[model samples]
Target: MPSLDPEEGDAIRQALGLDRAARPYRNHYPAPGDDPVAGRLVERGLMERGAATPAGLVLFQVTEAGARQVGARLPEAEAGR
Candidate 1:
C-alpha cells in the first residue's frame, strides 16, 4: 500500500470537502482510512494533531495550507464530503 505523503495532501483534502472558513470544526472527524492522510498532512504542515481526550477520542484540525489544498483540488472528486 502507498503511504500518505505531503504531495498527496491536496488529494486527501479534496477527499474531505471541508469548507475553508468553517473548517477546523471542533468536532470534525476523520474516517479510519484517513489516519495516514492525516499523518501526511501533519508532515506537510497542513494539519495538526489535537490533544486526545481521556476518553480516547482522537482530535485533528486542518491548517491554512490544508484548506488551500482542498480548495485547489475541489474539482477533482467533486469535493469529497
Candidate 2:
C-alpha cells in the first residue's frame, strides 16, 4: 500500500486510540467532523463508518489495513499486539 499523507496518518492514529498522548479509551472509534481526509480514507478502504449514535454521530473505525499501517508506526510494546 502507498504511504499515507500526513493528515491521513493522523486520522488513522486518532481512530486507533494512539493519538492524544496515547490515552486509551473504551470507545476507540472516533467521529471526525466533516473531514475530507477521513472521507478519503473511507474511499481508500482504510477506514469504515459504523452505526450512528443516538445523537446522530457517525463513528469511524480503522480497517485491518489501517491498523496495520498504524501498527507499523508503533513500537511493539505500544502496539499491544
Candidate 3:
C-alpha cells in the first residue's frame, strides 16, 4: 500500500470528493512546488493535473487507484469511470 504524509493525503481526499462548488480548493490549497508526495502520486499513476485553463487554474483529477486508497465509495455518476 502506498503511503502519504498527512497534508498530501488531505489533498488527495479533497480531490476525490469532487465537490468544488462547495469546497473551492484552488483558492485554499497552494500549488505544490517540487513536491515529493505529488511526484510519488504521479509516478504511481494515482493522479493527474490537466492543462491550466485561461484563468490559470489547473484541474486535478484522481485516478481509480487514488480513490481506492482513500476508500472513497464513488457514486454511480463517478463509479468505474
Winner by TM-score: 2
Candidates, ranked, lDDT: 2, 3, 1
Residue range 1-81, candidate 3, lDDT tens digits = 657667666767676543443322231222453456565666777766554556555555566676667665444554444
User: What tens-digit string does per-residue lDDT give for candidate 1 at 1-81?
Assistant: 234455465444543444353333332334343477667666777666766756665555555555565543223332333
- Give the TM-scores of the predictions, in the order they appear: 0.47, 0.67, 0.59
Global lDDT of each model? 0.50, 0.67, 0.56
Clashes (N, CA, C under 3 Å) per candidate: 0, 0, 0
- A best-first ranking of the candidates according to their TM-score comes to 2, 3, 1
Candidate 1 accuracy as lDDT = 0.50
Best by lDDT: 2
In candidate 1, residue 51 scores what lDDT? 66
Instruction: Identify the superior model by TM-score, candidate 2 or candidate 3.
Output: 2
- C-alpha positional error of residue 62 in candidate 2 after TM-score superposition, expressed in Å: 0.2
Q: What is the lDDT of residue 20 in candidate 1?
A: 50
Clashing pairs in 1: none
